[model samples]
Target: MTTSHVPAGAHPNDGHAGPRVGLFVTCLVDLFRPTVGFATVALLERAGCRVEVPRHQTCCGQPAYNSGDRKEAAAIARQVIAAFDGYDHVVVPSGSCAGMLRVHYPSLFEDDPDWGPRAQDLAGRTHELTSFLVDVTGVQAVNDQRHDATVTYHDACSGLRELRVKAQPRQLLASVAGLTLLELPDTETCCGFGGTFCVKYPEISDRMVTEKAEMVASTGADTLLAGDLGCLMNLSGKLHRLGKAVSARHVAEVLAGMTDVPPIGAADGGDRR
Candidate 1:
């Protein structure tokens, strides 16, 4: 239950000067779900953003910080700040990481007179992907492709609780032609994969994910969509473990119409969409 420090009156960039965006590719998306990263770029580019992936960017340090390793967390935080220093706005596909950059970074540097203000400035300019699209860029919908399957959304803890990302992705999803968004039971509850929490307390994580899997099953949706891959993976793993049939996907993948890619449990068929 960490407190979020989103700046007051902060909103997404409105394509002012054709905003230059630095994509903060989270460690999970970078290592495991590169497709989400690619789809994020496609969505942003389609909305007329000049997107750049800062090569030096690394993890947002949420894991280290949550594990009580402030020193290591701050070190990684500095690396991220330095990597995207010149960009007009930082856009992250993962709500957890984006929340770290926008809410926790400033607090991490609060005692440093030199870095604190800079960190605050950086935090102020960052935006979660869907929020940036609907709020800043005024993106109504994507025009490239559409899916006809019923989809249920899972609101990852960080995005829903810290970044207030509930309606943004839904708004975008609604715009997709032929896509049906279904309501999941207990949509706001955590899927219990709090980064290392899943690894540390496998029993609890398994129980939570089992509950989430049941909710997804109740929806009768063919696809489960979430903004954060951590929650998606947790739920997806549990779905596989339970021999359930629902497929999991990142919100960017759905919004970008990359449904041609098989669902999470499917065999390694290459990206067809």
Candidate 2:
């Protein structure tokens, strides 16, 4: 993908004025769920942030790093670290990527004298999307159209276990007008889409997602929501494959009221819900 550069002054800091944020659009959201990216921009802008989508940014090296490919992982990690080096903070929509940036990057460079500290510094400033929205930006709610639908959220593994991104997205979702947040059974269980793990172990992935789908189905919610696209995609794919009627959406998409987009596998002219 060709990198798009945002000139230094492209995003003017008007809200907190702490640090201009380099919005890290993860590969999944970039390719499959562009609406999530747009919603993220809307939420951050609503929260008074100077958001910039740095074109040079790419994968967070989680897949490579998790597979024990340190050399390639470090190379990509270095590129990501350098791309957003001067930004005040790196805001990412996915918990997995945010955790990788905030947790793994520093470890990747721990032994290096120069890049190690740089990675640590970058890690220190990284914030998951909802965390930045509710905590850093102090945003209480979004002013989107009211949708009276019961929604349940799935906590992605890296974000929940590694980054502790549990309540932030829920809090933000609860604040959305006319939306009722429903509780899911065993909400914290892994959805089995651990990057390449699903591909490498298809059977296990299928079983995990099937169980997750069952939990989501039991909620009687019209919509199933989650922060990370990986979990959403996995659960949604299985749900679609099974011909279940529940619709799946990203938290940002719900909060931003961009529900006009069709659910997974629907035809272009088909109904969204």
Candidate 3:
């Protein structure tokens, strides 16, 4: 819904050298697919932003917070806030993680006057990767890598509903030379990988993902791309199990021309990985 690149500002300023951006590598990207984090760095640096990865970073605390453990969640939030407080802005590769920082962090510190303002400040400056690229830095294009396969995009729940990130990625993808952008039918629908939801209700999650995979296949896209790793993993895993050959990758990898890594949920013991 928002095409403005300012991250939190109504009018983004791209005139000076890029703002100092602290890159928060989400837990999934850190453990399962580190290439996405690197690709994010590639894109951010290309946008003229000076990016830094804090060494003391940990989980975004969404699991604990959602589980109703306010104490542990607040502790983790404070640590994360302290780690990146000096940066001009904080950018996250995953919308889920960015949503935690931007939407939930302030609430975590509501009773603490000292930390509440800091949390609000961090929230105001934090942005999802694609949003930051298109809105904050005004980057129109990245690397010139072209895919031979037709690619369709999936709108992850958090990025679509929480961040209102509908158009920025499609706008940037339009400029990818030789890359065919096929819009998936019902792209905004959830793929049922709601972090803990899939684990709590496997049958329901499987049914939802089955339909989502069917939608992806209906588009005849050889490659499936999305901003959130969770949704990509869910859909790609289902596609793999169904014996479908749809390849999946984070949008950042494609945009940065770093698609050499294995696609999400690649078949075990396969050369594609």
Candidate 4:
């Protein structure tokens, strides 16, 4: 979507001396929702990070890795490792991608001698976006952004179970003015978008997401927010099919005040910008 990396001097490196963050804009965010990528950059810059979108960055090989294709996954992981080398931290907007980098990359190379050490080093620095802002940068609040909606948060499985991203996004959302967060029923349940899992078992996936969407609707919140785009897209599509009124968005959009674009799975399907 024509998004440029945050170069030096674009934002002052004040608080944390601008940790070099290599933004791993996931494939979904890059193709379906570019606003999330832009919002992530805004939030990182606000927290005093010198961000860069490495041109060589590609998919985290999550689909292949999950599909029992270790050979291809390892090849892609090697490329990702090389692309994000030299950065102080590699931050991803999606928890699933971040989890792959932080949790799975090392295991993929554990038996190897050369790439194994490199994978561990990179994994240590990998972090989800909200977690990086709150934990690594010590950012307590977001400034100048407000959402006056009755919002419900869905705990994406990867972010919640894998990365323990339970409270980081909520902690920041609490700082947002005019926002009311209503907890969703069974927030920890999967929305059924397990990377390639949905494609493999559409019937099972649809059933799970249908239940999740019903839970979201039961919350009676006007908006639904989640850390991972995959979950959001799955729920958003289900909600639309059910004719539910809730709008779905990446949490970074509201936190960074970049919600001028249409919500995910809108009737018009949103622009690529």
Report the C-alpha lDDT of model 3 over 100-219, residue by residue, as the tens digit: 999999989988999999999999999999998878877765545565668999988898889999898888787677789889888778999998989999999999999999989889
- lDDT ranking, best first: 4, 3, 1, 2
lDDT measured at residue 17 in model 1 versus the true structure, 0 to 100: 38
Best by lDDT: 4
2 against 4, candidate with superior TM-score: 4
Tens-place lDDT per residue, model 2, 116-135, is 99999999889999887777
Q: Estimate, for each residue in 1-273, the C-alpha lDDT of model 1 and write its tens digit.
A: 000121212222244536798999899989888889988887777676778899997689998999999999999999998898988889999899999999999999999998798899899989999998887878766664577878899998888888999999998888777889999988889998999999999999888889989989889988899999889888888887898888889989888766676766566783222
Ranking 2 against 3 by TM-score, winner: 2
Give model 4's TM-score versus the native structure.
Answer: 0.93
| Count of residue pairs whose backbone atoms collide, per candidate | 0, 1, 2, 0
Instruction: Measure candidate 1: CA RMSD.
Output: 6.6
- Quality of model 4 by C-alpha lDDT: 0.88
lDDT of each: 0.84, 0.82, 0.84, 0.88
Give me the runs in candidate 3 sitting further than 4 Å from their true place: 1-17, 267-273
Model 4 lDDT tens row, 1-273:
111123322466655476789999988989989999999998888777888999987699988898899999999999999999999999999889999999999999999999999999999999999999888888777875678888999998888888999899999899888999999877778999887889899999999999999999998999999999999999999999999989999999998888778899875655311
Locate the minimum summed-lDDT window of 10 residues in model 2: 1-10
The true-versus-predicted C-alpha distance at residue 205 of model 4, in Å, is: 0.8
What is residue 73's positional error in candidate 4, in angstroms?
Answer: 0.2
